[model samples]
Target chain A: MKRIRTAVQIIFTIFTNGYAYGFLRGKIYQGNLKYACVPGLNCYSCPGAVGSCPLGALQALLNRRGFQVPFAMLGFFFLFGSLFGRFICGWLCPFGLVQDLLHKIPLSRKRKRLPFHHILKYGKYVVLICLVGAGSLFLFGGFAKVPAFCKYLCPSGTLFGALPLLASNEALRDQAGGLFSWKLGILIVLLILSVKVYRPFCQYLCPLGAIYGWFNRFSLVQVHWEKERCISCGACQRACPVDLAPEEISRSAECIRCGKCAAACPEGCLHFSKKPGPNPDTKPDLKPEKRT
Target chain B: MNVMNQWNQKGGSRQHGSRGWLFGLLVGAAFLCIGGIRGELAVIWQKAVMICMECIGIG
Candidate 1:
């Protein structure tokens, strides 16, 4: 499943950003299909990118008056989030693909699990609320300039959108300044961290991930834990790359729905379900039976 | 940890029945219709095609 997912990610990445020769000429695709959202964190400025990024669109629109709502972009997000949730992160995002590939690099430590990882999961939400949501709307919107998140943070933008342009355009390289260096530093740090920590950007900084994760409870495709079938074997927990125990598999907001846990389950107790289930609650015992 | 262990040990109904699917479809349709009316496609096109100097922090 993981191998297939990775293949799909690569294919989607190429299909969306396939103007490979454009990089040499330093030209971004200026076609009509560019209006469509690719449902992932692909950069619009990528030479081969045929679709716009939802985050970038949202930010871009913020700086323009009478475009406050960003209805089309929000609609795309609403549809995709409702259908797949963070499955896009696991299965389609180019940057997510990059992180997974980076983490696969042979290292002294096979996997480095961060302590208080659950607490860190909220970081992405904070970014969504403050940087992407507020900063773009309030600060940059008033200034009628570039969005704050894209300018200051967004390693994916730096890596896919900027780095390629810089490599190809000599004038762009000569014009590189302090902000470029700062973004490069961020990109370097994220790239190195991706090797040690599984999807550090998705877990800690991606506003897109945070937005999609909220819909996980309602997404049509979801992980359903069959308590009756589970034998309490530790295989699923052991197999989880992000270190989520079997019980935590369905509910963990940070779960990318990568299917590692489902694959590891010996009894096939874990599976995807289209039926509506109680969104997994972090506090299982205290969760009120809201349905009943 | 103990609560998680206990919760995992217990058996219960796995999935629920909700109107989320219906609601989701309605919301998606509404957004798409409004987006079409608003000329959001043109906005998306302009943004996507333009070289965002700010995206690279060049500004």
Candidate 2:
């Protein structure tokens, strides 16, 4: 079963993200595979997306001034996050899988976990506010628009989004300047980090993951625990990829609901449920008067 | 540790024991193969979304 599921995952990642589409980009704009995520973080600007990426849409909305907020993209992010939490980060996000693949290099450790994580986890929100704020300032035509996040940050956009654009249009590459250079530097830093760490972006820097985490507590989709049966062996906590103590906050809003905890559970106590919990406080009716 | 031991013992309804994953994989593979075969972009996206949903811990 695990092998089959893994194979399915491999095949889907191959086709959906346009690992195939990159081979076909720019030859024709209307290729059949253009709809896929187009593996390796291809840019939305390459022009094959039937539906725009949430980040691209967010950038577009922020760069236009009619709305005080980028509400449409915000709503989409919330809806996706609410439905799956960081599950998208785990299973579907094309870039996330990239980070995961990079983090698996063999490295001996005197200590397995990092000693310092004091403030890095908040990087994504910083990415969110700083870039959005800067872009908003330039949108009024008093200044020309530059996608600040795409320019100064966002390794995915640099590696996946910009390369394809550069390859396809000589004009765009010729027009590029320090902004493109800046994104390349960010991508380089991210590449070095990915080699050493286990998904630093998702851990401390993915605004998408942060947004989704807000909804994990209330989403219909959930990790349900039978607390009554919990023995506290600590397997679930260790199995968690995000380093969350799964037993303490088994269904925590921050949890992406990844099954590593369940898979690690020698006990069958952890499972997904449409309803949120095996609520410990609730009691079943045992009233004698009901017999009357 | 004791609570976990109890959990290990507290079996409830019988699980199908991983058949669900098998079924999901077959369905997902079918979507991928079919999408590849027919060149239906919309169908490819829809199937991709569905596969991602199940592969997601939730379902």
Best by TM-score: 1
Native contacts kept, each candidate: 0.57, 0.04
- Candidate 1 residues A156-234, lDDT tens each? 7788888899889888778889998899899999889889888889888899998887666567777777765566667
TM-score of each: 0.88, 0.67
Segments in model 1 whose C-alpha atoms lie over 4 Å from true places: A141-143, A276-292, B1-18
Docking class of 2: incorrect
How well is each residue in A114-152 modelled by candidate 2, as lDDT tens digits?
446646666667766666456544634335454455555
Range of the 10 consecutive residues with the lowest summed lDDT in candidate 1 chain A: A283-292
For every prediction, compared with the true complex, DockQ reads 0.38, 0.04
Best candidate according to lDDT: 1
Against the native chain B, what TM-score does each candidate's chain B reach? 0.58, 0.38
Query: How good is the docking of model 1, as DockQ?
Result: 0.38
| First chain TM-score for all predictions | 0.91, 0.77
How badly does each model clash, as a count of residue pairs? 2, 12
